[model samples]
Target: METDLVIVGGGPAGLSAAITATSYGADVILIEESFSLGGQLRQQTQLHANLPSKFFAERGTSLVKRLTSQLETPNLKILRNHTMIGAYKNGHIGVTNGKTTFEIEAKKNIIASGAAENAWIFPGWTLPGVMTAGAAQILLNREFVYPGKQVMMIGSNSFALEVVKQLYECGISVQAIVEASETILSRDQALLSMCKKNNIPFFLNSTIESVSGSGHVEKMTIRTSEGMMEELEVDLICTANGFSPILEAFQIMSCDLTHSEVLGGWLPTYSVNFQTSNPSVYLAGNAAGITSLGSILLTGEIAALSALESLQFISERDSNRKKAALWEELYQIETFFNKDTMLARLELVKHYHSERGLPLPDFVDPLKGEMLFG
Candidate 1:
């Protein structure tokens, strides 16, 4: 198949990019690995402080609905139950829908592939009842299948808290939430309050010493803050250590990447507009790095616009003007619930601007993490 743009992933970012590209008169083919389109958005059930959350608590599901409704243009083609397998030379992409593999010749590629949940491994983690917090979330929210009668979570970040909330809503019980770190990175009071209301105990400065079970996880040992070990009996163990960008496309393209724990592990250094080192490829959303959902949408739109411009599907002048316009529009569209996340935007821009030989933006007092232009 030959198209002006080949987008991988059918999440919010991929859908947004496809919509924007087709609106600009570019032919688009969007491929998603799942049977449905929403990606992780389908599992999420929290209200962020972003623009969309102002109107709805279930913003991810809502965005999925809104984006799909707008993707009715004739120039767009969507392939579900499909995933990109490789990126060959000369802008060719290899994709598969399980039974068959096909090649696509594209002028430009947008990798809104998003992120993958990170599970910090522990003994007995391979047991049947042990899973990632994300797995637990999907089991309850999407699959409508409960993980276990009683679950123990091994992380206390916002994501973990969200999973715990969903578990409660699913009529399941969470035994405890454990964090090895000494401090909680996210300070969302609303999330904390929800945990309190649910009576889910949050344990910090603690680590799961080991998990033991014959067929499924039945019990685990946790080292508490006081260096005392406590044994908890639980049927399911869910770990949500963190997330890393899903960089299969980058790996296929052999793009230069770096490992940044702060930026969510090995990822390509994204230019201000989320361009990877490879000229023909670009990244957006969690694929570049973790940020707010609103910010992810902005990057997706911007990346689509950039990709279209690279293919001469849109002129440079028009792209530059639109990008300038989007910069202001981005602030209006995105909202940060935690004040600390505001600095992530700064770090993304400043580092990339310097890499591109553009003037670097100025720094805030490093609150939790920077300077940027007004």
Candidate 2:
């Protein structure tokens, strides 16, 4: 197959990119490994804060619906159940649908392949009743099946808190929330208040030493902050350590990568426009970095606009103006919800530009009235 643009992943970011590219008269092919789009958005049951809007909120499902509704144009080709196996430097993409393998030759490609959940390794972690928090979420929210009667969460970040909230709403018992840090990692005060209101027990500065059961998880040994070991009986164990970007295709394409703990792990080095070292390739959404949903959506559009500008489908001047507006909106969202991450991104951009012997743009720190670079 030959196309103007090929998008990997049919999640929110890829969908946004496809819609934007197709609207601008680009023939696009979107490939997804799943039978349907939406990706993790389908499993999300909580309300997400809208971009640059303090009072407005939208559910993930609603956002998915809104995006998918706009993809009826003939310029867009949907390839569900197809996985992108290889991305080559020569603009050839290898894809397979379990039965047949094929290749696509594209002028430009956008990788919004998203992120994978990180595993928290422990003794007996491979037991049948032990699973990731994401798995537990899909079972509870999407499949309407309860994972267990008593659950122990291994992390206390935003993702873990959201899943805990859902588990509570479903009338399941959360035995305790265990965090290796000294305090809860989640910055959401509202969720923290909910945990307090419900009298949920939290084990801070703690680690699960081991879990044991004959056929499944039956009990766990936790080392508390006081250096005392405590044993708890639980039917299920959900680990929500964190997530890392899925960079298999990016590595295959040999895009320059850098490590940033704030950005969720190893990610491609790209400009503010989301163009990577490989000019023909771009990245968006979680593939770029783990960030707010609103910012992730904007990245897709920005990357699409950059690709369109390269193809001369859109004028560079017009693309710059649109991208500027998108960047401002993204900054606003990140400043509100992810100030530290936004600062880290600015630093990363500066480093990328400096390493290439390019002039660094002047950057002002949002939190402090000070110049970061000149």
Candidate 3:
């Protein structure tokens, strides 16, 4: 199949891009590897904590519904259960829907492929009762199945905190929260207060030495900060160590990449417009970097606008205007919820400028609300 634009991922970013592009009369194809759209939003059961009042307290599923509702434009085609396998330099991409493989040629492509959960490996991580926080979330919110009767979280990120609250709501016991850091990593004070109110024990400066059971996880040994060993009985171990961007497709497409620890590892080097080193390719959402949900949605629309401008489907003047507004909102979200990501992006742009021998004065740091190169 061929189209004007091909967006890989049906999550918030991809969905937003498709909706924006299609509304402007672009022939858009949205491919999702799952049977349904919404991606991680389907399993999210908490309100957005750091967004402005307009978006704050809104559920992820509600955002998914809002974006998907505008997807009925005639210029848009949805391909569910399709996986992108290969991306060629000539604007052709290989895709498969489990049984048959096909290729789709497009004038422009956007990868909002999102992220993968980071693994926290310990001596019994491979056990049956051990899983990622995302897995437990899907089980509880989507499948309506309980991951375990008594769960112990292995990380203290916001994702893990939210999952613990969900478990508490479902009447499941959260044995404890173990963190290898000196302090709790999650910045959401509300969730932290909730955990405190419920009296969930927190083991700071601690590490899971090992977990043991006959065939599944039944007990875990923790190395506490005081150089002491402690044991806890728990049926499940959930790791919420955060996520890394999925950059396999970007690499296959030959987009230039750079590493930033703050951005969650290697990501495609993108411009202010979200265009990658490869002119026809763009990135959005977690595929660009780890960020809040509001920023992810803005990146999607900005990427679509950039692609549309490149295709001449939208005038440069109009595109710039729309993107300026989107960038403002993006910076607001990042400043309030993802300051680390903002700094990472500044560093990424500096590297991009240096590699291309572009003068620094031509670039501005919108995230910092100041001229970084002047």
Candidate 4:
């Protein structure tokens, strides 16, 4: 397959870019690995703050439907269940449709492959009923199934909170919400107060020591400060350490990446136009940096316009100021949410391949504990 623009992921970033670029008369090909096209947004429970009011509290599945419908342009060709396994020089890409390899030549490439959820393993994490909070959300939203009747959340971050919220909406009970940190992180003080008023048990400065059950998770042992231990009887455990970027494409492309604790370990440096060190390639969405959908859309549109400009299709002007305003709006959201600190702590981890002379994480048993990223 060949196209003027090849988008590597069909999330909000790639989908938005495809619609905008195609409307500008560019032929576009969008590739998504999953059977569907929404990416992580399809797994979310609630839309976060700072977005348009209409999108507030919208469900992930609903968002995917709306965006997918808006993006069905005549010039856009979408390849669902297609995965890009390798990238080559001179704007060539290698993709797979599960059984066959397809080579694509592109005038410009945009990577919106996005990020992945991180799994922090502890005792009994390999149990059949154990999963990440985001994974649990995927089960509920995508499969219309619950992990179990009762769930014990292992973290108190936004994802974990959303899992609890969604599970409640699904008529499942959350036994407890445990936070290893000393305090819960939240931008909305009212939400925290509501949690307290609802009598939901919040354990701070605590950690899950182990999980145990006959064949599935039935109980979790949590160790708290003051040398106290508590066994919570729950049918499922949801570990929520947070998210990290999907960097396989960056590694294959040989782009220079660094471990920025603020950007979730490995990330590539790109200009405002989303151009990587390679002029023919661009990046957007969480692949550039973990952020909200509003920011992701703005970055994607800017990248599309920049690519058009490079091809002598669009001219730069003061009208571009709209992007700057969008950036500032996202800046306020980030500031209010305190994402900088969390991102700062995440910079401690990095990704490296054997030939790159960078040390990768030691996976004792990859299949048992590994998290897949595209």
Candidate 5:
């Protein structure tokens, strides 16, 4: 089949781009790997904010549904269970289900594959009972199951703390939240204070020495600051060190990629419009870098505008106008969030700024986003 735009991920970026592109009078198809969509937000407990409280209790799933439903335009098609594997020079894409590989030709593409959890190696990282923070969240949100009755939560960032809340809501017990850093990152200061108030000790400058269990995780041994050891008997250990974007596809496509530890690893260089060095292709959302739903949606719209311009569906001047307007909106939202302490743990915590009075680049590649945005 052929399309004007092929969005290769159904997460926030791809979905947002699809909606915007279709509204702009382009035929768009969004292919997602998993059966369900919503990307990372699907696993989150609540919508967080770095700005003034707008919609506090808005569930992540609810936002996904509203966006999905709104984007169900006749020109927009969503294909779930489609895993895109290759992008050809002519802009054709190869996608696979278990038994079939389908080729779809498109004038332009958006890579929004999102990100995967980062698994830090430890003595017991490979244990069966060990799971990423996102994985633990999936069980709780989608399957309506908790990781364990009593669990040892590892990592001290937003993802880890969010898991703690999820566990509590599910009526599971948290033995302790272990942090490698001296300070923990959480959205709610009240929650952090409560943890401390309840004497749920937060380990500072500690690491898991080993996890011991025969078949499943039974206990975890950790090294503390004073050269002392602590052990907790828990059925599962949820580790949330953060995430690494799924940028390997860009490498395979020979797109110019740079390593930005700030961007959270290897990332492709793309215009503000999400265009890679290969003008016809684009990337949006977490696939570019870890960002919230709002940012992802904005990136998707900008990317679509650029892609249409590349294909001559939209005039450069028109596309530029749209791009500028969207960017200004994004800037407003981002700037407002910069002062919010809740998102200190998020990767795009600060606005993109340059020192030495040098102006920032017009477009940032994925690799450079980490350094520039980090």
Candidate 6:
């Protein structure tokens, strides 16, 4: 079959893009790899203790329901339990459901495959009980299952801390959160207080030397900054070093990609419009870079608008107006959560500026987002 737009994910970006594109009069087909629609959204829950249930995670759940209902639109078709394998010649896409593979032609495509958890490989990481913090999250939140009785986390970022809270709630004891950095990031301060109050120790300037078990992870050896090894018993060693965008399909599409350790590894170097080096393929949401749900939603809309306009499905004037309005919404969600990301953002800007032969900026306005060139 053929469509004007094919969105390759069912998460915040893909869903929002589908909704916007159909509203703007483009026929859309959404392909989700999961059996259900919601993407990374299904994995999130309460972000902070201060916020009520109406915040990011809960709001995302509600959005999934609302957006799913909108799929009743005649122009929008959904294909679940299906995935696009690759691109065919002449704007056609190879889609498969394992047993059967077929092709669908589309004028435009938005890849919103989202982010994958970073694998911080160390000794014994391949142990049976070892898992990423994201996996632990899915087990407890979605499946109502306990990941482990006792766990120790490596990588003392906010994401890992959030999992620590959930582990406590689920009655899974978190031994300690280990950080290679000298201190926990400021963004994690709020939850750090909560964790300390609950008696979860924070290990600074520490790293896991190794884990040991016969068939499953049973204990770990941690190396402190003083070069002393501390051994502790834990059923699971969870890695929470953050995430990288799932960019394999984009790579297959031959989009220009750049490595940014700050942005979560190799991400498509798409322009502001989310257009990749390949003119027909676009990126949205975590597939571009990790950010808030609000930013992902706005980017989805912007990408859909660009796709619609590129296909001549929407008027150029309407496209420009819609994109400008959506970008303003995106800019509002732009805030540096920690110093590392902030510096990385600056580094990214410098790299791009160097690519374009422009002078590196002296300072970027944190609040106003103004760039003063050096």
C-alpha lDDT of all candidate models, in order: 0.77, 0.87, 0.87, 0.72, 0.72, 0.77
- Candidate 6, residue 350: CA error in Å? 10
Query: What value does the lDDT take at residue 306 in candidate 1?
Result: 86
Q: What CA RMSD would you report for each candidate?
A: 3.5, 2.4, 2.1, 9.2, 5.2, 4.1
Show where candidate 6 strays beyond 4 Å.
47-59, 336-369
Question: What's the candidate order when arranged by decreasing TM-score?
Answer: 3, 2, 1, 6, 5, 4
Selected candidate, larger lDDT, 2 vs 6: 2
Per residue, candidate 5 scores C-alpha lDDT tens digits across 274-336 of 667666678887777655566667777888888888877789878777776676556555544
Highest-TM-score candidate: 3
Shift in Å, residue 328, candidate 1:
4.0
What TM-score goes with each of the models?
0.89, 0.94, 0.95, 0.85, 0.86, 0.88
List ranges where model 4 is wrong by over 4 Å: 45-49, 52-57, 89-91, 318-322, 339-374
* lDDT at 266, model 4: 79
Candidate 2 residues lying further than 4 Å off, grouped into runs, are 52-56, 359-374
The sequence of per-residue lDDT tens digits that candidate 3 reaches over residues 1-374 is 98999999999889988988998899999999999999999989788655533455678877778778889888889999999999655658889998999889898999999999999899989998999999999999999998999999999988999999998899999999999999999988899999999999999999999999989999999999998999999999999988999988898899998888888888899877788998889999998889888888888998999999999999988988777777767766786786778778767766777787875432243544552531
> What lDDT does candidate 4 reach at residue 231?
89
In model 2, the worst 10-residue window by lDDT is: 362-371
Model 3 misplacement above 4 A: 49-56, 357-374
TM-score of decoy 2: 0.94
What tens-digit string does per-residue lDDT give for candidate 2 at 95-137?
Answer: 9999988889899989999999999889999998899999999
Once all C-alphas are superposed, what RMSD does model 3 give against the true structure? 2.1
Candidate 6 lDDT, tens digit per residue, 1-374? 88888899999789888988998778898999889888866767754122212234344456677768877799998999998888777657788989899987888889999999989888998998899988988888778888899999888777888888878887888899999999885366667888879988888999889999999998899999899999999998889878889987887688888887767888887654677778889888888777666667777888888888888878878777766666544554544333344344445545655576755322223312432321
Of candidate 6, the 10-residue stretch with the lowest lDDT total is: 48-57
- Clash statistics: count for each candidate: 4, 0, 0, 5, 5, 0
